[model samples]
Target: MYTEQGDPCKVLKLINSDIQSPQEGEVLVSMMAAPINPADINMIQGVYPVRPPLPAVAGNEGVGKVIAIGSGVQRLKTGDWVVPGHSGWGTWRTRALASESELIRVPSDVSMATLATMAVTTCTAFRMLKDFASLKEGDVVMQNGGNSGVGKALIQLAKHSGLQTVNVVRDRPDLDQLVTDLKSLGATHVISDAFLRSRDMKEFMKGLPAPKLACNCVGGKATADLLKYLADQGTMVTYGGMSKQPLFIPAGPLIFKDVNLRGFWMTKWNSIRSQEERQAMWDELCDLTRKGVLEAPKHRLVPLQNFEEAISKSMDSFTNEKQILSMGD
Candidate 1:
């Protein structure tokens, strides 16, 4: 837990706290696993929009088992696997006393990593693809940060829906391997940011139809490249700003192309949607996972006691694998 907003590795401290029994409409959950996401890190540093009160537990997403349920609880029972229905539930601890309304039970057959990690990245990807545009089979989608957790999820989900994705990644020493990895995930095309800007990009665009949807996680020049290739009247949804830079949109596309710009935040989406709607989405995603269509991103499982090491690795540059805190039973 942390008492102040600062570096996550510095401010976070592990401590033993007494376990609480479930009250009315509450359930006692034993956390199984939780992934450390970029939003979790930003929330730790007080940079994210959502901030729990100071001296609060640190994690925002994870999977847990319903060990006990209060008398009024009806939706969940003991042995049910669950994830937070919304963000900021303080999932870092081994156990949580949560209201029944705060949890969404999921299938136990899926892998722990996939269950723990899907609430954010996979949900975000699903929503962006489904809600943003009227994309049909064979329609093209373009996205930057192609190797990020959400990026990978989007690629796979799109492929399953018969949509094509043009993924953009930064140049790296292992660029070839990364390209192969993305292609293996069903990415239609994977190119470097530098390539997106080079003269060859014009020739490449001639071979494929313009993308109807462009998912922007990195802003600045990379986003500009997305806009440049977006189809007329196409939609570009900005879900994250990893570059920490303002978008530089050209006027021509906004005017002549009639391109639309929008933003999405899963937390906000959850807050406004009904429980049934949310459950339907979760059920669909879980079914996809069960069919082996949605696999967990690359990750390393760190014991919960060694959370500091996991946090350190999550903040390291060029680290591609996700850091997941595993709570052994």
Candidate 2:
């Protein structure tokens, strides 16, 4: 646990501790796996908007099996799999105790990685697509950071919903392979930011309709470029600022095109929505995972003891694959 806000590598250290038996309305879980997301890293550095009280646990999302339940617990039982109902549960540990209301039981058979990683990325993608715009089967959706966890989830979920996607990625040495992978995941078009700006880019969209919605994760110029492809009066939703740069959209889109800009934070959504509403969304996303339609992006399973190394890798701008902490049986 960390006592101060600083470099995650320097502040977080491995510690052994004991957890008491479940009290009333509580459940004890043996964590199976958890992902190291960008938000988790930002929270560690004290850069994220939401901060847990000092001496907080390190992770925000993961999947675990219920090993014990207090007398008052009714929704979950021993042997059930569950994800945290809210954020800042300190999920990085091998096991944890949570109130029954703070845990959502899910299918135990779903792939550990998909279930472990789904709570944040897939839920965020679903909400962005469902809430921001009224998209038809053939309507188009475009997004930057196309290879990110949320980006990949959006591609799969969009394809399942019959919406087309134009995905943008940074120029990488494996650009061709990355393009191929994204296409396989349901992206209608996969192009680098440079390619998106090329002369022939407009010509390439001749058949497909202009995108009605755009998901912006990487802000700054990347968002500006993505905005250019949005159809007139389209809505652009900003959920993250990976570029760590200010966003500047020309006044023309806001005034002339009548485009709309909005922002979404899952943390805030969870805080305000009814439990039934949140549970319904979770059930839908988890159902998709069960059916093999939605999958987590490429990830490496790292033992908890190697968390510092995993944190370092996740902080690298060039790292494309996600890192998940494995709580070995």
Best by the lDDT measure: 1
Model 2, span 1-329: residue lDDT tens: 89898899999988899899999999999998999999998998999987999999988999999999888899999999999988888889898988998888888778999988888888999999999999999999999999999999999999999999999999988899999989998898898988888998888877789899999999998777877778899999999999999887988778778888999999999999998999899889888887878987899999999999998988887577899999897
Candidate 1 lDDT, tens digit per residue, 1-329?
Answer: 99999999899999898987999999999999999999999999999999999888989889999999888899999999999998878888899999999999899999899989988989999999999999999999999999999999999999999998999999888999999999999999999988999999999988988999999999987778999999999999999999999998999999999999999999999999999999999899999999989999999999999999999999776677899999898
What TM-score does prediction 1 earn? 0.98
TM-scores of all candidate predictions against the true structure: 0.98, 0.98
Compared with the true structure, all predictions reach lDDT values of 0.93, 0.90
Which one is best on TM-score?
Answer: 1
Candidate 2 wrong stretches, greater than 4 Å: none
What C-alpha lDDT, on a 0 to 100 scale, does residue 27 get in candidate 2?
91
Clashes of each: 0, 0
Worst 10 residues of 1 by lDDT: 312-321
